[model samples]
Target chain A: MKYITTVNGQEYIIEIDQKTEITVNGERHGVDFQQLAESGTLSLLIDNRSLEAIVEEREDAWEVLLHGELYAVHVQDERAYRLAQARGKLSDASEAVVIRSPMPGLILDVLVEEGAHIGQGQTVVILESMKMENELRAGRDGVVTRVHVGKGDSVEKNQELIAIGDAEEIKEQQ
Target chain B: MDNLLIQKFDKVLIANRGEIAVRIQRACHKLGLQTIAVYSDADRNALHVRYADEAYNIGPPPATESYLVIDRLIDVAKKSGAEAVHPGYGFLAERADFAQACYDAGLVFIGPSPKAIAAMGDKQLARQTVRAAGVSVVPGTDPGLSDDELIAAAEKIGFPLLVKAAAGGGGKGMRPVHEAGSLSNALAGARREATAAFGDGTVYLEKMISDARHIEIQVLGDSQGNVIHLGERECSLQRRHQKVIEEAPSFVVDDELRRQMGEVAIAAARAVDYVNAGTVEFLVDRDKNFYFLEMNTRVQVEHPVTELVTGVDIVQEQLRVARGRRLRYLQDQVKLKGWAIECRINAEDPYHDFVPSTGTITAIGLPTGPGIRVDTGLYEGHTVTPYYDSMISKLICYGETRGEAVLRMRRALEEYRIMGVKTNIPFHQHMMESHRFLSGQFDTRFVEERFSMSEREIHDELEAAIFATLVAHQRSQRASQIVAPGERDTSNWKWYTRWERLQR
Candidate 1:
């Protein structure tokens, strides 16, 4: 079976066959993996080299600890993967993904207004929760099409606070 | 003669949770005292509770309703037949009222006297008291000043000063104003933060030492008033004024400076008639001149470094002092042995602005071997809740020299393994390899303003990627494996149906 694996925004085409034979991104690799009796522990031998990985299933993603750093991995099957690729294309064509609140908090301040162009990693909103200020930044560069919340507004986890879209849509809105 | 008799307690109740509580419990057990752990609703399954000889539920998850409730804690201690109460660092540890309550309940408070805690608990009052003891403070105004007066005081004290909340520490209610133009605004912001966090908006201004380091001396006193200092710990490596890393025998302090700071620390403790284990913190500037910051009237969180370097078990001394016994070592007998460094392992994601992460620890691989100690409240399958502080463990390493200590810390950090939650281990690893940190050239702003994790890209990228891809591939295979729908020939109903069809 052929699988599309996406890690940190990079996609790889992996083909797995019987007898521990696999090809990753068109490059063949002979890998054997054994799930140890201990949960979330994996022992892998890649091209006769031994490696260990600790994996945990978080709420919506998988957290893998390799070496001393942690990586969040998101995996989707073939059909879901295709749908995600189409969605990505659609978003790139016109609109941008909406920025949502990562946790429940009070919107202490909003840095930008609608119709304003924003670059990626620019602070759009400042949230104060648990007595700490959290700066919510834009994940991608786009023009602010709409602002859904204002200062002092309490927001729930994953609640949409701002919508970023292509320049044309923002200009139309303006 | 009054202190000649050693008072003993059969049972001591640890009124705090997390690693500190577990630490106190260990001390109590070593001294042949039974430990009782009091927990909030959220900490029912905490490691401290499991480590205690007995456990009791005090109240709900919020500290105000549970751990910070003095009456509730005292009631639990009494009901559990505990003879003493040990409030470890946070929560009610530094609260004078809690200590008084413990005293009123006829229980030994395994800390300083209530008088000392009350005197030093107020930041403004502490400044006045320490200055009265002939120790120079950071030149801050007195409390109860109007906003207009605060601005005027800031101008007089100079443009660069800090507006600090008079009631609390830990970066809460503290704001640094670089010029007169921003003093009023900074004061307002500081007041709001202080009020929200500590329930007191009263703030004072102090000269801001831009290039200063946080150095604190540990002091132990008995009822007989014999106080001795335990050298100094460099806690300058902080993020937003919260200490992240600490080491004993500060690279900044030599023997003469250490002696001066130690004398000042002893004076501060003497001013308040402090007893048991307390920490006198100072802000040392670039010129080696130190100013008294505040006195922490309880055993500090980073006491382990001092313990390792001085070969003095601070908790054990705190217990003994509470028992009215004289200190084990005099001022001259107190000696500094080796270098010790401690990295506070907090359950915070360093890459994501140090936000608190919570989950059940699925797998853990703690570092072991010589000269390394991991004081932790973490257990396999233990859950880290969001209702408390993010600190999960403290990894301390000791060595004959600073370079050796750093190397050992690097080794231990590499061996430290925790899953199911994010940590600042990567950041520590980055710091271990940092040139400035290795050279002992960093200040409080080193972490926030100077240090950047982006620079230290994981060197083992190729290895990590290979392992990750292999794991991912195997996971996908297991998930996609098609299981046989059913045992086709083992169904009784299907067998009877086939027989009937054959008969027909």
Candidate 2:
């Protein structure tokens, strides 16, 4: 069986086969899906010892409890997994782009029209929260293609504020 | 002083928010006092609002228009028909003018006298009053001393000294100077911080001890002028001057030392003619000698640890005291029972520079069973807002001895679970397992020196956890897909089929 895993925006391809035992990330394990189902548990061989974990499905993700510690993991389907791998390859070629909240706030002011020209680290929006003020800064010199939200908005964790594309790169693509 | 008694009222208006508000509401309910809560726009759905019998939104999110606005809070108090107002710990708790407003409005204020609050609110004046009461204070000049005068006083007090704001506490507006060369800079910084934090930059000087333990004596006073101390609590485990863990009965304090500290605390309280519940804090050194620090004229966050050991409901006592009742138990009658430990459960990511983590707590399983008490303002689905203190809950454990209490606390921490937001639970778990902490051989700088994870360590741990998660995720996916269809063939290739099934 072959599977692709994405963690923290990074992707990895893993292959498991019987009699072809291998260790991944320092944890040695023999792959046997039938044994795992019969025992109702999966055991990973780490340092010549077996460690068991109970996997449970929880609302669009799998929660694996290993040694009394729980980990939340989001799994991607085959199509999305392929796209994520492609995205990973493209990211390696381009300069890393990062977006930061301009202000320490609730992001009450996002003034950049999407697909607008923005300089590197330019102040794109203002965040007003906790009785203080902060400004959102752009990641790199690029053209904003999509604005995720507008004025007087509330954003959750990792909610997209804006999308940026390199002007020269977009021109070349067109 | 007229007898300010709380006439029989069904409900109390808690004109505050956060953990303290929830604390007061719990105390009120224990006494059969229903609570009315008032909140700002930002805190309309806060835990305190949900905990109260009734909640009203006063104004906008800014504190100036809501919590700090005396007129608005009074209006809410009136509309709710609440007979008394409990200011909890902060916001309006220390505001003498606000307390007087409550008095003038014919509503009972569940705290000390406004005059007492005013006297103690000014740090320097409180020191002088405590000194006059024969309580040994830190060797420092009174407020209004010139720089030259302060420098000379510092020399007399010795090279290492502290320049503190006369109107501030909580590590604010305080500077520790080691030598004469740093005096001017320290004084200037202290003044600026004092002005910004307390609105008054009047600075004072004190002898700074290189290693000091913060011990506070809890004092309860009645309107009839009776006051008594409920022993001491050692709160030296601090980070950035905020207490992280607090325990009752100092490790070095014996019966004699406890008596002396209690007497000084009582004297300090009596000097101000204080009423209700208050804490007289002190800085103690290795030799058992202690000096008066400052008087906190409101209920403290660590009040539950005291309640657990002494079996006294300090908040209920404050209400009873406000109602012109005498101390229910005498000073000698109050018995300090077994050890009690309180861990402040803050909504902070200990791995990330102790930064405040704000979000909804999706799942919460509080520790139950004997000897474990959780005083939390948050419930499942309660959003921890950035508008308040990071402390979401206080988990206290009590037992026959310190070891028993610590063991129980460790068990409680294991049983307790909070998800959907980053918390300091892991940090507490690490600290509880530390050798120094278990042995109680720690000081204020213990956490800073020992538990602080280096940048490299943080990166490594994050990478490892992420890798492990990804691997587990892949294994689970393969197993699920293989098990989707029921096809069992266990005849010829039993081991092969088992291995193949597990691989899925």
Candidate 3:
């Protein structure tokens, strides 16, 4: 069986040919792992090198902690990957940048107006949650097409607040 | 003669939460006194609440409704019969009114006199007070300085200064002006941000001391007019004005410099008539010219570094001072024996601009061994709500030399683990391995401008990929498999156990 894994914008083509053998990015390796317990601890032996990490499954991704750093890994089988590619849904942020509220909060301010060009890491919206004003920044640079939440409006977790598309699309709308 | 006959308080009501509260409880226990913990609705299962002799629910999770409510805190103290209240670092720690209320309620505040807190709390008044004692302060103009006046002041204070908002903190409304040409534009931008964030446009100009290290003196005072300094703590490693790493007996500061800074710190404490534990912060330039920054009226977050080196328990001294007793040590008795370092373990993603991360801590593996002390109010199942500061714990390591301490800290960082939330442990680990940090050549802006944690490559990426894929494959396989019932209901292991019993 073959699987496609994406991590930090890098993709890996993994093939599980044998029980204790696998190939990642065209490199074959002998790999075996045991789940220590329910605490997400994993003792892995890859190519006879013993290692340990804490791995947990989230809603849409597999989070792996190695050497005190976390890597959010997205994996899909070969067919699913091809299907996703056909549908143009590959978790790419530069295509259509959407700003979602990470937690429940009130929209303190909308710093950008519609049809405005915003840069990556720019504070597009200010959300006040738990009495702390957190600046929700844009994940990628794009032209804003819609402002979903207005100032002073309450928002829930994962609620989309703004959508930014390519510059050409905004020009057409204008 | 009977000043020590009556104890100040039999029970201490800790008017704080999290690790500091637990820290205070440990101190009170060492003194043979009871501890009363007050918690918000969100902190019911917190380690501090569980460790206290008695716990009380004050109010809701928000600080305005719970931790900062003076009346509610006092009510809990009174109901619990706690004769003294210890305000830990944040929350109501530095509130002079809270201390006054504690005094008015006939309770020992376990800190400085209310007048002292008020004087130091005011930035201008603190400058004036410390200046009267011949202590040099950072050159700056008064608050509400207009843009035109600021431009003029910038020339006097020289270039590479900071235009800071009077009512701003956490690096908001703060702009760095490298030259006079940008001072006006910087002022306008800072004013706008300040007005929007703090609702006040007041601004000030301070001469930014380049190549400066943040060294603070720890002073402990008793009600008997005796005060002594417990040496100095180097806290130059900061991110956005918040301390990330701290160590005692700064590498830059020698014995003579330590004594000089200690005297200045003691002088500032005397100026305010400060009682209990306080830290006098200073900005020491490259030329060894140290100027007083401000005084932290309460115990600081990095007090453990000093405690580990000087062999002094500051919290216990605070309790003793609250009891109207003399200080335990004299100035001559205080000594810095070895090096100690502390890393603040915050629940923030260092890779992603240090944004606050919140979730339940499903599992925690604390580091233990030689020269390690972990101060935290966390447990396995504790939920890290987004209602407060992101710092979940402090990992401190002690050693006879700075190199040894750094090595121990690196080892401890590798051993420590906290699941279900992001942390800056990797950042600390990277710093421990960095050449600049090991050589003590970095300044306050090192983290903000120079260092990069994400630039380094993860060595175990291949192994991680392999394990994750294997786990995912196993899970998918298990979900697809359908188990069939066997002829024997019990397993082979159960039959073997029964056979052993029959043989017996």
Summarize candidate 2's per-residue lDDT along B1-504 as a digit string, tens digits. 244444456669998887788888888888888899998887777888888999998888666677878998889889988888998875678878989999999888889878999889877789889989998877777877888888878888887777887766666667767799999978876786566444568888888765678899999998777889898998988875678889997777788998999998988999988899999999888777899989999999899889989999998898777767788988889989999999998876675456567777666667899999998877766877666567788999998898898888888876676765667776776677777888877766677766654321112222223334445445545555555434643322243446577768
True interface contacts reproduced by each model, as a fraction?
0.26, 0.06, 0.29
lDDT of 3 by residue, B200-230 (tens): 6788888889888989999998877898999
Pairs that collide, model 1 = none
Whole-model lDDT for model 2 versus the true structure? Answer: 0.73
Between candidates 1 and 2, name the one with more favorable DockQ: 1
Which has the higher DockQ value, candidate number 1 or candidate number 3?
1
The segments of candidate 3 whose C-alpha lies over 4 angstroms from its true place after superposition are A17-19, A23-32, A89-94, A128-133, A172-174, B2-6, B143-205, B483-504
Per DockQ, the best of the predicted structures is 1
Native interface contact recovery, model 1: 0.26
User: Which has the higher TM-score value, candidate number 2 or candidate number 3?
Assistant: 3
TM-score of each: 0.90, 0.73, 0.89
Q: Weakest 10 consecutive residues, lDDT, candidate 1 chain B?
A: B476-485
Q: Flag regions of model 1 displaced more than 4 Å.
A: A1-6, A9-32, A47-49, A58-61, A74-87, A93-95, A104-126, A129-131, A140-159, B1-4, B180-185, B460-465, B479-504
